[model samples]
Target: MTDQPTTASPAATSPAATPSPLAQLPGAVGAPTAEHYGDPVAEQRALAAGRALVDLSDRGVVTLTGPDRLRLLDSLTSQSLAGLAPGSSAETLLLDPNGRIEHAMHVVDDGETAWLIVEGAAAPAVAAWFDRMRFMMQVEVVDASAEWAVIGAMAPADAEPSIPAAAPNGHALVWRDPWAAVQSGGWQYAAEAAHPAADYPAVELIVERAFLAELAGLARAGGVRLAGSLAAQALRVAAWRPRFAAEVDEKSIPHETDWLRSAVHLAKGCYRGQETVAKVHNLGRPPRRLVMLHLDGSDAQLPPAGATVHAADADRAEVGRITSVARHHELGPIALAIVKRSLDVTVPLVVPVDGVDIAAAQEVIVPPEAGQSAAVPRIPRLGAKSR
Candidate 1:
C-alpha cells in the first residue's frame, strides 16, 4: 500500500494533451462541469466504441491478504472462493444471516491476495464488517478505497490499440463482473504520489471540461438524449440487475435475490449464513418475487417509485409495488415491481398515481419457480373516460 497526497487535480486541459481517452471524464459527481453528456444512448455508444471512458473512481477498493485471505473471504461472502486462481475475478455477495445482501462486490484474486471492489456508498460498512469478523483469522484488510482510481471502458469485439498491459507492481486482472474485461494496476502521479490505477490504461485522455460538454453536445446533435436517474434505474431493473438496498432488503435471502448463480457457491462447505441459506433452499419458499412491469393506459404520465399495485379483478388487494420507473422514448413507460408470487398473473394490476390509473402488467423475468412457469402479464387499460 502506498501513501500519497490526497488532493485531486483539476479536470484535464485538452484532449490532445493526454495519453488516455479515459482521462477526459469527471472522477467525481457534481465536479465542475464545462460540458455535460446529455443522453444515455450516446454515452453507451461511446463506451461500446471505446471512444468514451466512464469514471468509476468513486467506487471503493479493499485489499485482503495473509494465509487466511481466501478462507476468510469464503466464510464471509456467499461465493465459493476455495479454488480461485490468481488473476481471476468473481462476483460475490456479503449477506446477513437472514440472507439479505449487505454488499455486492467484484473480487479480484491474485493467488495469494484478493481485492474487493464495492459500490462507493458501501465501502465503510463493508470494511467494518470484515474487521468485526476477523476474530482469529490470519488476515489483514486495508481500506484502499482512496488510493485507487477505477475506470470502465466497453469496446466492440475489434477496436483500438488494445487494453494496455498490466503493471508489474501490485496489479491484477479481474474478470468477475459481466460488463468488461477489467484490469487493476498502479499509476504514479509524482515522485511522492503513487496510487493504484486498477489496471487503467497508460494513455491519458486530457480534455478541458468544455470539450467534454462539446462532445456531449455532438452526441445530442446526433440524436442521442440524456436519461434521468429514473431511466437508468429502469434499465438496470429491466436487465434483472439488483440494486443493493431496493431488491436486497434486510429480510432477503440470497436465493430470493436470485444471486446464487452469480454470487453464491453451491458446493462450498459453510459460512456464517450458510445454515439459513441451506434451510431456506430446502424448506422455505421465496417471499416476494422481482418482476418487470409494463404499464398501459395513457402514456403521458408514468408510475412513480413506491406506487402501490393492486389487483383490479381480485378482491382489490395489494399485490405489489413499483420499485423503479423510467420513461424511455422507444419503450414508453416501464417499471420494476416487487410483488407477491401468489398473485394471479391474469388479473390486472393498477398503479394509482395520485388517483389516476397507470395501467400495469406483470412480466416475470426471474420467476418464483426460477424459469419453470414463465409468463408475460399484459397491461390492461383504464376506462375510456380515464383514458
Candidate 2:
C-alpha cells in the first residue's frame, strides 16, 4: 500500500446532505433510512443469491491514517492487526477492562489508510476513543461517517458491477465478513460440522456519500436493485452471525456470542481486557451463551429484539431474552437469543409475541460447555503422589 492521503469523491458529504435517489424508488418508505423497497421476502432471496444490494449507508466509517495506523490498532483492539495487509479484512472488538465489549469494527486497509466500518451510532465515540489512545503516535483518526456511506452485498468482493468502486491503489475498501470460518489465533465454539455462515458470504463496501445517488440512479435504470435492512438482517440471523448493534449490550463479552471465531485472537499479546479473555477461555465459561430459536410460526408474528424468552416448563421460568428476531424465507421465524449458560439445551423455550407464548426450540450456538480449552491438569492433593 502506498502512503497517500485518503480522499473522498467530490460528491456530497453526508447521507442527509440531500435526499437519496433511492428514497425516490417506488414502494420505498424508509429510503434514506432503512426500510425495504417493496417485498422483503423476495429481497432476502435475491440478496442471499447475490442478486441485490442492501443499503447500509447509515453505518459509520472511520479512517486511520499515517505510518502507525496498523500498529496503533493492533496495540489496542482484540485482533492482531499490526500486520494487516492491504485489501485484507478483519473483525475486531474493543473491550472494557472487565472484558465487556465496547465497540466492534470491520477493518480493511488500502495500504496508507485503515478503514473501519462501524455501527453508525457508535462512530463518534469510537473515533474519540481512538484519538485518546493515539498518545504520541503517528496515527491520525478521522470519523469519516459524514463523508462516506456503507453498502452490503452478498457477492465476492471482486465481483463486477455489484461492488463499489476501488481505491486509487486498485484495492477495494471492502470488509469481507470473516464469520464464515475461524481465523488464525481464533477459536470456534459452535460444534456444527457444517456452519450456517458457510452459506452467508457478505461484504460491506465503503463508498463516497454522493455515490448513493449514482447507485439509486442505477436502480432506477434497472441496472441494479436495492434491498433494505430487513432482508439483510434476516439473512444474518439465519447465519447465526452476531452483530454488535443487535447482539451486543453493555455487559456483552466475546465469549457469550461465540465471537472468538473471528473477532478475538486468543493467543495474541496484551491489550485491553486480554486478562479476562484468557481467564475465561482457559478456566471458566462465559456466564451467558447464544442460541438460535426456532419459533412456532403458527401466528405468523415475530418477536421484537428485546422480547423475553422463557423455559417451556409449567412455571414458564424466564431463561433468556431475544436479541434479534426475523422471519426467514425458508426457516420461518428465527431469533438469536442470549440465555444463562446453565439453561438446559434440551428444554424447549417460549417467546411471547403480544400476549401469547410462541413455542421455541433452541439450537445451541455457544454451548454451556464452551471454554476451558486450556484444560489445565488438576493439582495433586497434599501428600499424594504426583501422577
Candidate 2 TM-score versus the reference: 0.93
lDDT, residue 265, model 1 = 65
| Segments in model 1 whose C-alpha atoms lie over 4 Å from true places | 1-36, 45-51, 153-175, 178-235, 297-300, 327-332, 370-387
* TM-score, structure 1 vs. true: 0.67
User: 1-387, model 2: which lDDT tens digit per residue?
Assistant: 321122232234454334456767778877455568889899889999899998887678889999999988898889999999998989999888888898899999999999999877677667777887888999899988877888888975446437565585679787889998889999999999999998888988888877888887888889997887889988999999999988998789999999999999988889988999999998999999999999999987888999999988789998989999888899989999999999999998888777888999999999999989896898888899865
lDDT tens readout by residue for model 1, 1-387: 211112222224312122222233332223222122456555534443446545444455667878788888887777777667776667777766666666777777766667777665566556666766777998888766554434444323233322332322344443334322211211111111121112122121112223334444544454333222333343355445555646655566665545564576655777667767666555555677767777884757877677889887657788888877765445557777778867765677888787787778876644554322224464676653434
Best by lDDT: 2
Name the 10 consecutive residues with the lowest summed lDDT in model 2. Answer: 2-11
Q: What is the lDDT of residue 243 in candidate 2?
A: 95
C-alpha-based local distance difference test score of model 1: 0.54
